[model samples]
Target: MKSGVTNLFVTVIGLAAALVPVNSFAALGDLYEADFFSHTIFKFTPAGTKSTFASGQSLSEDLAFDRFGNLFEADGGSGTIFKFTPAGTKTTFASGLSGPFGLAFDAAGNLFVADASSGTIFKFTPAGSKSTFASGLSIPNGLAFDRSGNLFEADDQSGTIFKFTPTGSKSTFASGLSFPVGLAFDGAGNLFATDQSGTIFKFTPAGIKSTFASGLSSPDGLAFDSAGNLFEADFSSGTIFKFTPAGSKSTFASGVGNPVGLAFEPATGIVADISTRASVQTGNQVLIAGFILTGTDPKQVIVRALGPTLTSFGVANALQNPVLELHNSTSVIATNDDWQSAANANQIPTSPVDYRPPDSRESAILITLQPGAYTAIMSGKNSTTGNALVEVYDLATSTFSQLTNVSTRGFVGPG
Candidate 1:
């Protein structure tokens, strides 16, 4: 009888563990800023904590991390490249250039520096030997590399993108940009860049240029998240804007002071790098969550939940009904009431939803889920087909696990 009780207890514990929700873990590193005037590099953690990385430099414009995790800063005013270890040991890696603005690393771990004043792109080895990779033309400010090792540089003076081959041959990939400064490439090989005139542009590998986003004060630096969303640093307004691949723009962070350089730390998974022109440290980490739902009668679907903490809820419809829930994990959190309303108003369809429509015909829903483990219930009835499906996304991992399908009635929690 005791052995039988032990078996039943084990089974119940296993079932309870299966019902518990699993959260995707994300560690957001703080944003560090190297003030040009103060000549200091300040590091900010996600919890609004601050530390000094390095100090006593001259006009640091851009920063890049090496394979060994050492930070490299472009001191445009001094025409030098400052290299610092993670613990803040600073040294001059290279010097005596003519206004190096942006820096990037190639696949082979070579450093490419963009000299804006000389319109030149210089390549430097880890040993500090510098050579002119490409020269002559307009103000080259930002540098990026594609998967195939081709280099793309953004010219602020010409508002054009120059493609440099490994053999040093250069060609204009796209033209008619507005003082483009920062350049970045997405997973699809599409190039995204920001201009001083407050516009973002996207270029295909085939040389097709299109305006991806616009109407900013002065977009200086550009970066991408794991979800393919584009982020732009606005120098004029000291704000950071997040843009969807479809050209939709939203304010990611604001109240920055002369924000210029932007880089995403993939290890931390945050969007903004947030370096200002001055010395006061101010930065924060913004968490983003995404959800996708599909079914034949999604319009009849709804998500209901009583959180473990139960703060608020909302939703959005990137394609169909996208619901968001917010809970008070601590004493108080940011206002997430709008997200809850958005969730309640959004509804899913009853048919299969395709992310890429037409042949597949799937619908997608996006919502922000606050931190905590809670029970989420999705329910809908399709009168015509009697088929419904739901999917949950853990945005931090960039992984998608299907929760329910045609034969499933509803999802109690996570799988």
Candidate 2:
């Protein structure tokens, strides 16, 4: 259903657990979760296989990762932060801190932590020597860095988000939060903060805030997985929840007492869809979505235009009948009106690659393409109009080109 079910849910099953070859690095990809009350840590594979990553901790509140794949945890009760290697060996990364709650690593390999009790932020070298980075905060709990290397802190006491320059100059980025406790950033530079009041706020780089999500119960830590899904540690529910960039959430892990923090395995991200513009148009409007495939092998994707199905989702005046025309730039390569009418329609026998359209009226195309720029145009059938959804799903990761833009230049006039 276009309502939500299109995202990649990586439980510890099948392809999610299978190794992703990231160029030359043999990465041991695992999801690390910290249990504060039980004083232990658990690791889950992408498909949900659970195991102990580390244990024997004292109120560990958060976790971070370095470029080398090592993990660091902030022990609020012990007042020290510990670093753990891939081999599960722990070393005192920095000591004599005041309830270190949040941890982050800068681009230069230096580690930073929010000293919650002292209302200060600390920086440490790769060798573990510590120094004060910024001071005079009110219970700074959550720490994160933007793409520009600027650091941000979520203050639980003052309920504000503070921005710090690379040289440690501090400014109030956002204020008037309801006990802001966890901070995270999406790939688009939008910042997300979780509050004790059960809402997650999203802020642009310009600091304009909006509600990204709500109904969370005491979410205390935030971490984004390799696929860009945000995972939150819910202290009250004792569960870990995963949210898509659009803010639809599902349970990822549960039953551990007071889960406080999580970390995803590190990988370089290749962006999917450089630009996307979605809207409702009138008449027989042709919405063009273009992408340029690279590499030599053929790529597969599920291309579809949704209209009648949108009414089930509360969409008003949705295009009663929609048509899809795929182009290799200027020439039409494929056209479809009803998905079930295609010769190979419903031919996909299994899934993670399923292309079956349940509604006979929906238009879909399962295409195998080569290295070139192509476009998909969504239009109404015979002057029909209003609104609809045009979507493309990659069946084989980045094997296909990323969608460049979804837009329309030729407006449909009254027929």
Candidate 3:
């Protein structure tokens, strides 16, 4: 994040390289693709660097991630779902299923598994408690959830897509497809499904259908990056195709043998830190940072406004003093002109190691916010102006809830 002549960019820190602005890229974070025939899952970085995330599975069918950064895989041949930590340690999360094909996670951290052979949908709590969510389908191959919490299923055999409410109510979302094998939803409410007959279908929230793309080779799994680009795992072609929002396609990766499922690690998925640097000014030109917290639980974050301290790092024209304010939709929730004077001054220095503002005049705020939109503004006090930095750090990174969709806007004066 930065401010430079109306330029806008997003960066997800904490588990990747430092802040660098890029115009076009393959993915925001990491992308995981499962090869059904090889029984292996491979991970790729934004620059196309590849490595085996996990291997030696009994037919890896699908890949998904929980809010806590754990990766889940559906093992179709073994009838089990495996959970992998951030470091790739594997453990059997569930077992005794009749072919787990598609895996999805709801906002409440519940894992939904589509049993293709049994025609059943199973739900598992965060603690691994399982219950039957839905049943009597003709082979559900893919699963996804919309922002409204409605679960969508791709029934490959029946040629139908089904929508299920949070409480197990089911309805037909779309029908008459040519073996829909993969399902995904973009940031918008629109749904994308990959069909076995070399075509991708797009469905509106009202169930209206249209062909998003055609001439594929047995496309199986669908995933979308933060930039709204769709990645399709073309099963028979041994390749993955990336599609822009308008449906233009390009080869993202090749030589992938029988890729079945695709999932991006979600750069914006579980952000640990976000910061932006820009020239500060008054009124609308003040550095304003925006973020949205998803999931059910509240999140504790430390918001900071840096100015004088930046000069120690070779930043010139630093603001003499900075003031910071945190706001919800309607009103200001918290404000801090100086960190030492804040109500939680003692706790601010120790919230986390290596994150204390060196200058006492810098502004900081420690807030516990519920799931919603928020704004953090940084400006110089007394109508002063100079370069400054604004930052928000998530404190509870291991919790089920996370900070996401973070952005910033400000002015950029000449050096």
Candidate 4:
């Protein structure tokens, strides 16, 4: 029970990739939105700043990002597609389109556009050569390409989704959709769609369809983030909604007029790492782990320390009592002796904060922090020693919905 010998380990459960709400203080991602009525495209940063990404267009209906970081927008009114570089440089990539609505890129760099006015699907080469990939559709509006190079078009007028092979042969994929207008695919090869009826639908690789979510205000576009969070643009409400892989929904951004396109930057911001040990005591010294949070806003995080409960996991000699402290450099910001202490009880309630250690002797704290490096320390109370757990969870993204436990599993010992 001396003050310097120990071991530790932890497991974290938390939020996935999606557009985070601005107030949560975490940058969801770099997002580009198209205003169909204004004929403008706007860029939103994770820091909650909105600015013009590109403008001077005619009815920018949909957006897509290629592997090289170029942004593409389909101009329905001008019957053209415009491409933009990261520095906001714009150029016409394709023309002679007939009210292009949805835009997508295949793995080989070919572009596919859904022509609403002509009821045809057009394919564009990297060099701008255009050809009719599929014709005779009843208003193909939203387009998506699966991993296998299968092209999908949402025929809004016929309420049928059509799937096409890379060779251009087409077949009906699903029916009964209400004016389906946008389509996206997740990493697992599943398809998601939104429609004028304010519903979002999910489809399995085998063509099984199910309602992923309902009751939106005319959702028009669908896109997913690295962690499987689905984002949808609502044309009527001028808002964007985020849905978890499990179908939980939350408002991501709001107050834009006639939003038609929503695309996440093909990049990630918050990468988390956790360190663990089997046991820690005062003799083992305080277990300290550090992390850096980028951006200007304060990041809301939950920090916790666990003991006693490890016995359930077959951990022998679980720390009888573990204490936790959060620090900026060497300055202590918060500390906890027990998780349910009145000081932090108000902040640690509800589902996103679920999976609290069952042992009353555990410790936890919730903090909103500015951009910088910080450290979390876990130690046994009164120099008592045993197995324990320490974890830091980012709360900015999970503030609205089902944010599970933030834990990490690892083993640690001094050299």
lDDT of each candidate versus the true structure:
0.54, 0.72, 0.82, 0.73
Per-prediction tally of clashes: 28, 6, 0, 27
Which regions of candidate 2 are displaced past 4 Å?
1-28, 268-415
lDDT of 2 by residue, 232-265 (tens): 8899998888898778889988887898877776
Higher-scoring candidate on TM-score, 2 or 3: 3
Model 4: worst 10 consecutive residues (lDDT sum): 11-20
C-alpha lDDT of candidate 4 relative to the true structure:
0.73
TM-score of 3: 0.65
What is the Cα-based lDDT of residue 178 in candidate 2? Answer: 84
- Give TM per candidate: 0.56, 0.59, 0.65, 0.58
Could you say which candidate leads in lDDT?
Answer: 3
Which TM-score value belongs to model 2?
0.59
Candidate 1: misplaced stretches above 4 Å? 1-52, 244-248, 266-415
Candidate 2: give the clashing pairs: 11-46, 11-47, 11-48, 12-47, 12-48, 13-47
Clashes of 2: 6
- Looking at model 3, report the run of 10 residues with the lowest lDDT sum: 14-23
Q: Write the per-residue lDDT of candidate 4 for residues 255-366, one digit (tens) a residue.
A: 8788898887655434332445554646435565555554322345677788888888887778889888787755898988988884756545354236366888998877
Model 3 per-residue lDDT tens digits across residues 157-205: 9899999987889998898998999998875678999988799999988
Candidate rank order under lDDT: 3, 4, 2, 1
